[model samples]
Target: MTYSTENTLLYVEDLSVSYGDKTVIKDINFVEKDVIRTGNVTGQVIAFVGRSGRGKSTLFRALTGLVKPSSGKVLIADTTTGIDNDAKVVNEGDIGFVDQKYTLFRNKTVSQALMFALRNKEITKEEKEVKIKEYLHQWGLEKVKDQYPNELSGGQRQRTAIIEQIFCSGHYMVLDEPFSGLDVGNIQDVKDAFNLMTASHEFNTIIYSTHDIELAVELADSIYVIGYPSIEGKLADYGTIVKHIDMKEIGLAWKDFGLDHMEVVKQIKAAMLSS
Candidate 1:
């Protein structure tokens, strides 16, 4: 394989999001926001972190066209043809957005849902089945293919949602609290799945948002500490901190100390600065 040194993807300039008069993210800008640049290729993972009211989700929605931004332009290169509409222009199979409150269609069977996605991408029937099987097996959902969302456990449901998006050839995934409700084991499973997806795919990136600082430090290649109504945050490069700090200080674990782990905090901060 040849390596190129001039690849650039997904450029956002002075991006901001607003709800009527209330601004979520303000003057958010990055030359290569969540982008990887090679000679002719680029991939990147940007993890967004902030309090409940912060514009983390709002920024994501604006970039993906679900929400409109008050100012700035989001330039997604390498996948789409134009960046004019802001809502319409995007890379094909680029953004796989998973909502916090479960977005998968409960009526559709797992296989049917995945097939629907594949079909939308112009994949043939035979190819769709093959891909669905592959995803089901890899995600440990082979047994649940016929099960509905209501029948599965919370972890299984989340995995199903993630798998549906991935099978459609989505390279960039915007996971809104991907670990919404799950046990420690399930959380690990989600992480493993995410790792596997990134490892096997090309031009893949993830923008995961969560209030859990530990989750951010563990899952994100880079971390963004966002404040409310502001389109900016403190960004720490990948693995920059190894120690975890006070979740309360970061607005996580609110009033509960049980969710607080000092050792994890120490590791996160250490990892952040080390890298």
Candidate 2:
């Protein structure tokens, strides 16, 4: 416990996933052990950086409880007790996930989807409308509010999905390849939303998956380099801690360290390619 002042928000110990005979992921041991300051750790975001088809999506599914892990432990650190509790204790309401696949009610409009996300709130009808309107404006979906998911462009649809998930999510906001399928404008919106949510204490764990190492380094406080699972004539490998580069510690306040960052990115890519 003395290792880090930051409270452990999540712990994945010896985690593995399988579909009958084929193992998708194995032995993912991850923990946040740094003694980060409270302000720096509360909204900490982590990225699982790896190539596609490397079980990033599968691991995300297991983390969100969509699929059960074949072996090992998945724990959520309790804030009060500082205990890493079992995964069984996690409920659907505990985490909000923005999936890689897109799904929408073909019959409903973007406005309807936003309202649906807030259906459980005890607020009045007037409050719901106001909240929906605010979100539409904030997410650049005001013009497409009445448009069905199919009618909207790729960027609009992605914005709608992200805004809905953010509104519905409680503690953790786990996004699978959020940067994918987004335009420059929409990507900026999603990035701003992540920063806002973390700063406002809307979500504790803002984790995502991406193959772009540069984007991962620019965003996440920590990175988990997921290794490609083994096949025929290949050595078995799972998720390993390739490197833990703290962005806050990467650059100094007195000097310009932009070039230093570029070097780190290159080093990370080298490690990934070698892995």
Candidate 3:
């Protein structure tokens, strides 16, 4: 289906980020995107892909409203109709961010970490138990609830982190290089879990940054190939969206793409190179 304004869940308009005088990314632009699907669910899933140190993580931070953009705005849908994004800016609560390291206190069990997230909820101990247990069961995390972060597998730890963020924050989630350190087996497990949650509408939108092109093509509804531009004065600038491929419009099966998926992967890599 053609993408309209109403489906524009999160909008990034003329956004750029910088450390000081050195610009990390600039001219990050995206067109109106079409409907994206995962399993039985239809929502927005955007992927930022590029080489390491290409400012993908920084962009993720900006998207979550944790870091202010050097200029421009990240507009979100605050109404049923128009974007109303002229000067609109989203705050932290409108988005959820899970870091690449999967923030955890030393020696903290998954249950303990979750409880820490709820410390500000003002709910009683019993009430917190009920909520945490409900989500633990929902996320298939009951088996590892008692284990500390160091004791869990990579996939288990990642899943626990995601569950903790959703338990702590609201709907939208942004993951910074979530698949970076996982083994091949664990990578597939994390991918499967994400598909399951997204299919269930547990996350209204999921934005993640990765260097894994093949996986991004398979999982993301929209893939933004970020890279450092080599333009005259733009040298040394950070990454920006050079290619915006809406996977939903590609007409291949979701996550089940075979040979066709590789073709798209090659194209995304080509864009990465050109960016």
Clash-forming residue pairs, model 3: 24-238
lDDT of 3: 0.75
Model 1: runs farther than 4 Å from truth?
A: 1-6, 31-43, 80-94, 228-275
The Cα local distance difference test for each model comes to: 0.62, 0.71, 0.75
- For model 2, the stretches where C-alpha displacement exceeds 4 angstroms are 1-5, 33-42, 77-88, 228-234, 237-240, 249-257
Better of 2 and 3 by lDDT: 3
Candidate 2 clashes between residue pairs 3 or more apart in a chain or in different chains = none
Instruction: RMSD for all candidates, in order, please.
Output: 8.9, 4.3, 3.5
Q: Over the full model, what C-alpha lDDT does candidate 2 score relative to the true structure? A: 0.71
Task: Go through the candidates in order and give the clash count of each.
Answer: 34, 0, 1
Model 1 vs. true fold: TM: 0.73
Models sorted by lDDT, best on top: 3, 2, 1
Summarize candidate 2's per-residue lDDT along 74-157 as a digit string, tens digits.
666544453543223344555678888857778889999989888888899899999999878876788889999889887777
* Model 3: residues with Cα > 4 Å off, grouped in runs: 1-5, 31-40, 79-88, 122-127, 230-236, 253-255
Can you give the lDDT of residue 261 in candidate 1? Answer: 46
